[model samples]
Target: MLLFVIDLLGRTGPFSETLPAGIQAVVAGSAQKAADFHVNPPPAAQCASCHAEHFQDWSRSSHARSLTSEGFLRTFPQYLDFVGIRAREDPQVSMACFNCHAPLLKNADSEIIRRVAAFVVAKDINKLDGFEVGCVACHAEGNGVFSGPIRNPKGNLFHASKFSASYKEASFCATCHTWAPASIPCSDVYSDWKKSRAAKQGTTCQACHMAERVGITAVGLPQRKIRSHIVPGGRSADLLQKAVALHLKAAFRQEHLEVTATVRNLTPHRVPDG
Candidate 1:
């Protein structure tokens, strides 16, 4: 089944460019900026102020360690180096990844953007931790923001505040979930979901995956009225468990035993399984 999906996705690669303008932009831009770009951050400490509880929850999740982990680093030593090379060779792609993964704060001055761009071009992966996708990376504000900095991206803006009705909506997830039209078939989770019955029925990935442990029909636990920020549940836990299990398997295998493991995506935006 997975191979079928991959083949189907591969078939779509050539035709994907025929998708709409916005989709084309995403695909082309994502491929182009896989490495280099600059982005300013939002005001400092504002993210924490807005999502204190959620921030804590996210810190506990594996997603928090997306860009930083000794285990991941040891296994994929070339990620940073490759990013650097791509940044120099393909500034457009570098910019795309940087925007999604290591977004800058709004308060970051112009110089900050310049430095960020330079670092991205240099493939300075260490900066990934300091300016990585975090709790605010998704929830703070912007259209279709997943994780990372929101460049000069503009649209109906959402702001976080203590007194207002929270505006954490599906569009936020759509930013990352939706694939650029021109991208390969495997790259379009967001768009796939958008066309799915889930989206039409107003069921969001967050609703099923992040809500408290009430019945699937009623996940709104009284104490946890809002959704969970922990970002667990769904097949994600299954996937992560697979990662750990693979590591355990590797550890148990004799190092001297001749074996080869092809780690497909030990880097950002690449498919881990596909």
Candidate 2:
């Protein structure tokens, strides 16, 4: 039955009403638990005041728009419908979508998940307006602790700051970028990179997505190699165009034309990766 469901999902996307009873029950149970969980972090505005440059860059990134983007808004409902779940009736089902898009809520207790799911189902966008993938989502470690890659960050008057080596590693991005939920490979970019030459050379997701820049992480801090928050990905047409090189060769023989093209992927991961 599990194999059957997986096969069916592969062919039909995530929107199938004929999923096995047991699978549906499992999904439903997970949804119930997710609906009950709820956690809220500090707003982006709080971070903006101190890390102006980082905040500004993030404001224009896809991470900031993850939840509210038109693509996500449209696809989320289709996913729910495919899985035979309703946002209002079984808000827990939406947890899978929120796990990455809204990590803050992903940590929430079951009750809070339910409450927030209700708001989502009712289309009450304002209720969770400021709680999308904001600055605090990745930087803040629950409560008030904030973390980053800087070893010895100096001048920070607002909140508690800490240095974490993990921030500089590619595994940090695996949390979301390589996550496979419900037997579906959602974003396998990290997995692809792990097996790539880049990983062997100690290259990390930050190396590409968050390119380095000489700037202050926060107010009153010295200039340093701070990772930019621009976070470009596959959607970046300019980046994509430059990520590969195409070489073409043509020959004519006996009134016949033959062409050979060699494509090289400049990036570590697979071309057209998520």
lDDT of each: 0.42, 0.67
Candidate 1 segments exceeding 4 Å error: 1-52, 69-93, 105-130, 139-168, 180-186, 213-224, 233-235, 238-274
Supply every candidate's count of residue pairs whose N, Cα or C atoms clash at under 3 angstroms: 24, 17
Best by TM-score: 2
Candidate 2, residues 1-274, lDDT tens digits: the string is 2222111111212424464344454334333333322213444644565677898998888888777777776677677768884454564677887888777776566666676665655566666654577777777764346788777766433346788888888888888887756545366788888888989998888887888888977766677777788798888887788788989999998899999999999787777755
After superposition, which runs of candidate 2 have C-alpha atoms over 4 Å from their true positions?
Answer: 1-39, 85-91, 122-124, 180-185, 249-259
* TM-scores, one per candidate: 0.44, 0.75
TM-score of 2: 0.75
Deviation of model 1 at 267, angstroms = 25
lDDT of 1 at 38: 25
